[model samples]
Target: MDNTKIAVIGAGKIGGAIAIALKNNNLKVKATCRTEKRLKELKSLGLD
Candidate 1:
C-alpha cells in the first residue's frame, strides 16, 4: 500500500461509485467521465 492513488477511467455510474467508495476509505481517488456533467458530479462526490 505504498501508493493509494486511484484513477477511475470512464467514470459513469459504476466507476463513480467505486471512486467514491475508495475516497470514503481515505484513499486518493480521481475519476474521468465522457461529459462535463458527469465530471462535475464526480467532483461533487469529492473525487479529483
Candidate 2:
C-alpha cells in the first residue's frame, strides 16, 4: 500500500464505490458513514 492514507468522508453509495475501488487497488482506505448501519456495511466490504 506504500504507506498511503486515503479517507472518504460521507461514504454513501458513490463514495462507498470509490472506497471499494481504491481498496481493490490495494490502497489504504478510511471511510466514514453517517449511520452505524452504513458503517457496518462498509466494514463488511473490508473498508476501514
Candidate 3:
C-alpha cells in the first residue's frame, strides 16, 4: 500500500466521522477542527 496520509479539514460531525472511519480502517489521518477542544477530541480519537 502507498500509505499516503489523509488530511481531513474541518473536523465537524461529518468530517470527524470520516476521519474516524479512515483511522478505524488503519489509515493515517490528520484532522483539523474549529476549536481547541474539538482538536483535543480528535487527538483522543487517535489522531495526531
Top candidate by lDDT = 2
Between candidates 1 and 3, the lDDT winner: 3
1-48 per-residue lDDT for model 1 (tens digits): 546899989889988888888888889988889999998888887889
List lDDT for all candidates, in order. Answer: 0.86, 0.95, 0.90
Model 2, stretches more than 4 Å misplaced?
Answer: none
lDDT of 2 by residue, 1-48 (tens): 588889999899999999999999989999999999999999999999
Cα RMSDs of all predictions?
Answer: 1.4, 1.0, 1.1
**Candidate 2: lDDT over CA atoms?**
0.95
Query: Best candidate per TM-score, number?
Result: 2
Candidate 2, backbone clash total: 0
Can you give the TM-score per candidate against the true fold? Answer: 0.88, 0.92, 0.89
- Candidate 1 ranges with C-alpha deviation above 4 Å: 1-3
Off by over 4 Å in 3: none
